[model samples]
Target: MDRQFEAGPRVAAVICAAGAGSRAGRAEPKQFREIGGEAMLTSAVRLFLDHPRVGHLNVVIGAGQRARYDAAVAGFSDPRLGAPSIGGATRQASVRAGLAALDAEAPDIVLVHDAARPFASTGLIDRAIEAALRDGGAVPAAPVTDTICVAAADGSRGETFDRAALRALQTPQAFRYADLVAAHARAEAEGRDDFTDDGALYAWAGGRVALFEGEARNIKLTTQDQFDDDLLRRAGRAFLAQGDVRTGSGFDVHAFGPGDHVMLGGVRVPHAFGLMGHSDADVALHALTDAVLGALGDGDIGAHFPPSDAAWKGADSAQFLADACRRVREAGGAVAHLDLTVIGESPKVGPHREAIRARIAEIAGVAIGRVGVKATTTESLGFAGRREGLAALASATIRLPFRDEDGL
Candidate 1:
């Protein structure tokens, strides 16, 4: 008899273990501290290794803790797990280093998690990966159920804040590999180091960050009291070990008809004639929009924002693309990954790729790492060779909740 089988998505796990954990008052980093008969790092690594969607793993450890983390994780080894790399002084720096250590070949997605969050559930990781693959940047987060406060430094009460609008962020934040690399490069070049987490970095780099409801049990073990095996087990109770993955493709074209400027992927390219259309007619944005819409099973750009409607006349194509992404989210589907290619002859895509990716991420409501925008030429073969027009292609993946849950 034949057997039935199901496959999960492929994702690379990047575990950040470089924090000193001074607040925990431990000689060893909190990630390396013993928890439930094993080092915290061991438990954390095991979570990803055992996860069905996890295809590759890389650990970023403090320079001195490399050997310790290696030894701790040795017994749980698998081909998916890569060797540990020495990390930098800051969390962002450590992430950059960890990303650099990724195998030369790319994976479908990359999950950047903190080893300190030992209680992170496999379900949460799967959900995050699903969201990242669908929405561009998916992060595990819990809504703030309690009343919030804006307090003074001395602990004196100040203004009470609205909890409804607040969310407590957590991790195993996942991104598409190309988007993450580009965001890191932009941040590093801009000399920014203030990001508290990878998601923040993505947001700072103009990438959209979508929030997924996180399990209360999936807490980061920042202090001794936060480390409880029973709590972790309880948190994993509602978690399912399964995951899903899908891919979609997008294509767009704009002819050089008449205008002073050409818009490609939301960036203005100086030219004699612009792509003529109802909107700004950016081929890149249209392709990406179609890709995202396709992943969500939502109809294409024309279906959502019709050219027949004058409201979109000469409107920024970037916003139109973004609105399409918003509709996808409202429908309970999340964008996980996106890859885009721009084909043009005159206005070079290489010089504007990063900016274009950033714009697309912003419009699609995803982190920069979840969006990939590249450029190429047809070697002057078709109308593009005569500088007559530009074209673009894009692909996207999305995750939808099993039953249309409200928060996730």
Candidate 2:
């Protein structure tokens, strides 16, 4: 029985990645292959998981692929992502398995997508969901540019198709959940599993599938040549040009106070006395955060988080660094590297260098290799050398899209 489409239906997505992808000439499945330094499956799943309209999500993986699937989605956790479903022999069976897995959620609408097509934008997903809610079923398609012809057994053209009337289909095909479930069930009952895509399967079951515009960049990675570096650059997954690189430096100092330990780079180190400041006095993190802001051409840390505010009293300075990194990302940039030098006569940073580096990397969402932590002594010449306080100097290197006004 077909259920009627309603307003604001609960939308779910099924990422089908069970095929062997032998045509792509890869040892592993193409979906598990890397694109822009990330698994194609990961790229595809991230899109749907990030979309506000997508409610529940699931990925259908081939058998004996649990390890690969785990590796692909490592560090990715969201309430919307459900358990991975093991797929069957054929693509049709795999999608059926995925749909069956989602049956427990009982979504009102479902989008069946190919994991190899990672460039499906949020706007495309929105169009799919909207068309499904309004038309019961829909597929995103672009008009065919090349003239197509039906060839005979000997490869001679038997019929020619008007290019204007032809369309190249792309996933994710959307459908009313119950209606699609029923359609797949009918096909299974009739021993028909040859349908190329969900849209074709639904149409075979007498479901009228609608069409919406699809992006030219929303292409499927079916051939080995499609995995070119140019494609990654087009997807914004590649590193920016060197001309966009920028560097900024920052320095901070704090006086000795009456406390047992001090926070430095999000790590607590035992000391004779803590540094005095409105916050926890993590001078290392403060300098690094300021350095990031400086690279972004933003104001210093004090301007963003004033010490005059009581709300920041004893606040963890890691939050400050995290917020600064967030701003860099929001400004369409990435933190390339961070270097910090701590100067003090006591509470030696040598023992905590690795720990501090890891913590800073975690806060900045970069690799530990990108973070450098070191210690230096003032030889008892300055306040830091006299054990009166601690000081930190930081340098941050960032990459951003270059602006024409910079006159590179």
Candidate 3:
């Protein structure tokens, strides 16, 4: 419930995602597509949900999209987000449906946005709200930079005009709650549902519309080329730039015990003996769990799941690593990479290296490429050389929102 803005009028947002976006060149709608390691819808919802001014929000979805929507926002909880509003065939209708859903709460201001455009920044939202409060309506727009042209029926240029007065309008358009409701009502009554955006509808209904600055990077993903590896990398960097990077290291040792298999990185490798620990003696995962916690400065694994607690007796260590990853997410961060080195002599790690890496990646909810597993021997100088125990060293790299020096 912590926010960064001063309190004002109650703000709500309608995220329009009901359209069957065939142009995005995907089987599913573009809003359900993956962007920056998450669904486009999730990114958009998180943007408005995290804003201080927004008190209520609703997502308008097409029929039969409930399952996809649930999976995209799985584990996310916020009182501001209500049930999904059933949308009509058109974007205008979909937005109206969302607006109608919010009629019960009747927020002071409403910002209508496209779920496809997930990169809109908080500053842009601030400008839109400010303009809406000053004027009656606001639209985020960018100046047209390309040469003006007119296309004819035969695909020929008809006219060339000056581009100075041209502007490319974007979404997250802001308007007074009552004014927008009245505008939509008028449009529906007149059987006019052709308005592509709310700003135009409001304007046609005699509402004053003002323009505000828009970010160049606030793009609506609409093509397959936009999902290219290189483009996504740049987009990920832009998204992650708001956070600071951190790295932490951890080490753990577990002696041998009587068992048929040993758990390493959540994988059971057949061995003559297993590692000894309070839980499933997963040395690799325990070290990784500690490394992740260390990066967040949230203490080690023992602090969160104490050994004295009988509840964790014989528990799966994968849950420990999963919990650590959850904490990072709750703190508004993401795991960038994880590296683990197993030091042992008995259970040869080479044969199960790929499995260990895959298991760790699955447990951490990251790509397999982001998880690295390596094995080394102690050269007959330590307990690992004598095959008395197994040891692991791990490092975790994470990205977190920038905190003031004193804030930590």
- Best TM-score among the predictions, by candidate number: 2
lDDT, each prediction: 0.77, 0.88, 0.87
The sequence of per-residue lDDT tens digits that candidate 3 reaches over residues 49-141 is 656567888999999999999987785788888999989989899999999999998777889999999878766777788788778688999
TM-score of 2: 0.60
Per-model tally of clashing residue pairs:
16, 0, 0
Instruction: Count backbone clashes in candidate 3.
Output: 0
**Superposing all C-alpha atoms, what RMSD in Å does each candidate have to the true structure?**
14.5, 13.0, 17.6
Kindly list the per-residue Cα lDDT of model 1 for residues 191-294, writing each as its tens digit.
99767799988877777888887878667778655645576555444232212344667898888887887887777877888897888888888888888777
- The lowest-lDDT stretch of 10 consecutive residues in candidate 3 is 1-10
Runs in model 2 deviating more than 4 A are 1-6, 155-159, 228-239, 242-407
Evaluated at residue 2, the lDDT of candidate 2 is 44
Candidates sorted on TM-score, descending: 2, 3, 1
CA deviation > 4 Å runs, candidate 3: 1-7, 233-408
TM-score of each prediction: 0.54, 0.60, 0.58
1 or 2: which has the higher lDDT?
A: 2
How far off is residue 128 in model 2, in Å? 0.8
